[model samples]
Target: MKFFTGFLLSMVFLALASCDSGDDAGVPDKGYRYFPLAVGHYQIYDIVEITYTLRDPDTARYELRVETPDSFLNADGDSTYVVYRSKRLPGEVAWTYLDTWSARRTPEELVVQEENIPYVKLRFPPYNGQVWNGNAYNTGERDDYQLDSLGQGQTRGAQHFDDCLTVLQHDNEDFIVFLDQRKEVYAADIGLVYKETTQLSYCTQPGCLAQQLVEQGVIYKQWLKEYGKAE
Candidate 1:
């Protein structure tokens, strides 16, 4: 059985390259510009997260706003952007700070470190079907990241984006056996648009495994609401 959960964009003209990974550090390619990692750039989103436990399932709807307000140097001496994230529930005018995320845009890759898990969010020169190991830092697991689409238009809610790209990330079979399945989607310039993860395990008898497998599963969906550039 499956439980249904109900869910929840923007424009700024910044001349950036689309599709085409340029040469190495010495090469002057604008391919990495698709993401536009600047101090004054920010995005707001409406998020819906549903969790299904063995006993009951619940849903949470909130508004998430992330902003690139500050920057600092990391241990490697690379300057990184400080992404401040805040959350607001429905019918509330105040936003509370949730956490802080870090993004480092190198010539080769755009690295995002969230919750202490570092992810190579994007490789230079965006192209269709380009695959990379996003979970290279984690020794216990490997996640496959691929550029599913590029140079196409995408629309969500009342906002529309041109020259957009979508990247897909998936877990390996070993991880899937325990997690069921996990998938993530990221849009060019806009960042993450949608994400869905399902976890289901089966056992012949109760208490047969360390953790009991339930008939219910959790699902989460996030969509872009509105976005703007900082002054």
Candidate 2:
């Protein structure tokens, strides 16, 4: 009788442990905090763009400020936030309107519409090595975007972020002809901290075929300079 009672108690404990494990597994991770979007939240970034040409490369420097000031329901009845972008040249005091974009978050993914094109920017429960189609809703060709270095600390300029993740949008390089690479980094509470895009066409002439000399293309880099909430 004593042995039977002990066995029964052990079985009950195991069953309860299984139930707890199942409940925990059913709850999805809240990785969307890495790309937080809230009304009145604003971020400023320093932009440096270099356009490569046959002659010397042309460089442009400016500052971009993006803010979320309003939210509205989309056609699907989902809440969408309006992102307003403004730019200011160096030594300027006023910002010039650049453009407007929209972003929405779903249970499984986050979508951003830029220039009327919807892009799946990030998938929920983001983990290292996770890949998804960035142009899933657009008519563009299939583009795989991957996440890496999740929960890592990153330092941008003098600002240091305790937690951050990187999304690699595209990486295609043919050393002899062309190269294309794009990536973005986001902090836990900040939307975007750093973005880089490199597109280059190398000289394929017989004399420069193996030299990998860039003939024309562009390199764009944006770094977060400030972030806060508007009154």
Reference-based TM-score of each model: 0.73, 0.85
Off by over 4 Å in 2: 1-27
Q: How do the residues 101-203 of candidate 1 rate in per-residue lDDT, one tens digit apiece? A: 9899876788888888888878987778999888876553777788888777777666676766676676444332245555555555666655566665534
Model 2 lDDT tens row, 141-202: 99999996799999987789999989999998667788889999999978889999999999
List the pairs of residues colliding in candidate 2.
none
Model 1 compared with the native: what TM-score?
Answer: 0.73
Give each model's whole-structure lDDT. Answer: 0.71, 0.92
Each prediction's Cα RMSD? 16.0, 5.6
TM-score of 2: 0.85
Consecutive 10-residue window with the lowest summed lDDT within model 2: 21-30
What value of lDDT does candidate 2 attain over all alpha carbons? Answer: 0.92
